[model samples]
Target: GENVGLHLPTLSVQEGDNSIINCAYSNSASDYFIWYKQESGKGPQFIIDIRSNMDKRQGQRVTVLLNKTVKHLSLQIAATQPGDSAVYFCAEKDNTDKLIFGTGTRLQVFP
Candidate 1:
């Protein structure tokens, strides 16, 4: 059987510094990618997204980069803050519109 998904479990960063979270996906057929941030007791919030046609996309203080050749995705956060502390997830959407989420990465920001 082939593997279908992947993720990094945790990341720690210093407040006021930049943070980079990485993810690897197994479905090469997936076309859309989304990054989500989940706070305690809250639902996942949309942070950013990129399409397979694009190699990179940027939002406010966040950036998402996709490498189809390696089936890798990365999220970069500038000037990480306390509010940035949370669990982050990467999701892939196939042509069927089904989204498969990676395990998750808990981002801990220390002051």
Candidate 2:
């Protein structure tokens, strides 16, 4: 089990702007990573993904950058909006059936 206090979730973002989120992973063996955008009370949707072998991955209005050397990662959202607001989560899986999630970033859109 992980520390609960260190793993609290959610991030807040503004409307009509850009947002950058950070994630820290503890497992070195993880080889594949994905960034998912989840709206209020809904399942996660895959936005973008990157392999351990690759340093960067991009999608429409969204981008994921992975740094395996230091086990760090980031997600970038361009021109954020109210509809684009949600909880962003990063998942990692390496030959395992289950994926481990990072502390979620909650994007809040304000008009």
Candidate 3:
């Protein structure tokens, strides 16, 4: 089965800088898109999501953008902080309605 994957295995960002995480999927049947943040010892926390019908969606300090034509997705974090450091994952709901996740990118925030 095809799955989603990240372009970068790790992303290094300075504190207070904006961070962008990229993901790609091969399945066009994916409808719902979600971004998740996972800390070292905790489960993945939902950040934001966008439906297939929508191109973009925004949260408090996060934005999720979906490009159905290119099968691409991105998550942008505004004013990234140290606490925002974690492994970020992009998930998509397949045709079967099962949530499929990417390989995940580790967000390293530096002061």
Candidate 4:
């Protein structure tokens, strides 16, 4: 997966059993959604994706919920561990060359 950034800061999360990352999108016309995970200093890895027509999408222990009516979304991780710790992000695209992404969520692994 490829991530496009525009000089934004980062959001941090502590290591734990589970974590919930929230995202709010501006484009109500957007119909595509994807959640990506990026480990320390690495490229964003595809976690899961959902089309606008779907309200929820899930992947190995991860779930992405889309609220099309309000244009809000969230990603939930289960049994979060050290190795599972990473920055998570949500993206949306609507017939555009690039997908818009939130700042980022960095999950810290505490030993």
Report the number of the highest-lDDT candidate.
1
Per-model TM values vs. the true structure: 0.91, 0.85, 0.90, 0.80
User: Mind giving the per-residue lDDT tens digits that candidate 1 earns over 1-111?
Assistant: 112112447788999999999999999999999999988777889999999999999999999999999999999999999999888889999989988998888898999
Screening candidate 4 with a backbone cut-off below 3 angstroms (N, C-alpha, C), the clashing residue pairs are none
lDDT tens digits by residue: candidate 3, 1-111: 122223548899999999999999778988888988887667888899899999999889999888888999999999999999888888989679788988899899999
lDDT tens digits by residue: candidate 2, 39-65? 656678888989898998888988888
Superposition TM-score, candidate 1 onto the true structure: 0.91
Whole-model lDDT values for every prediction: 0.90, 0.81, 0.87, 0.77
**What's the C-alpha lDDT at position 1 in model 3?**
12
The list of candidate 3 runs beyond 4 A from truth reads 1-8
Please list the residue runs of candidate 1 whose C-alpha ends up more than 4 Å from where it truly belongs after superposition: 1-8
User: What's the C-alpha lDDT at position 14 in model 4?
Assistant: 53
Model 4 lDDT per residue over 32-79, tens place: 988888875688889888899988887888889999888889888887
Q: Give the TM-score ranking, best first.
A: 1, 3, 2, 4
Candidate 1, poorest ten consecutive residues by summed lDDT: 1-10
TM value for model 3: 0.90
Model 2's number of clashes is: 4
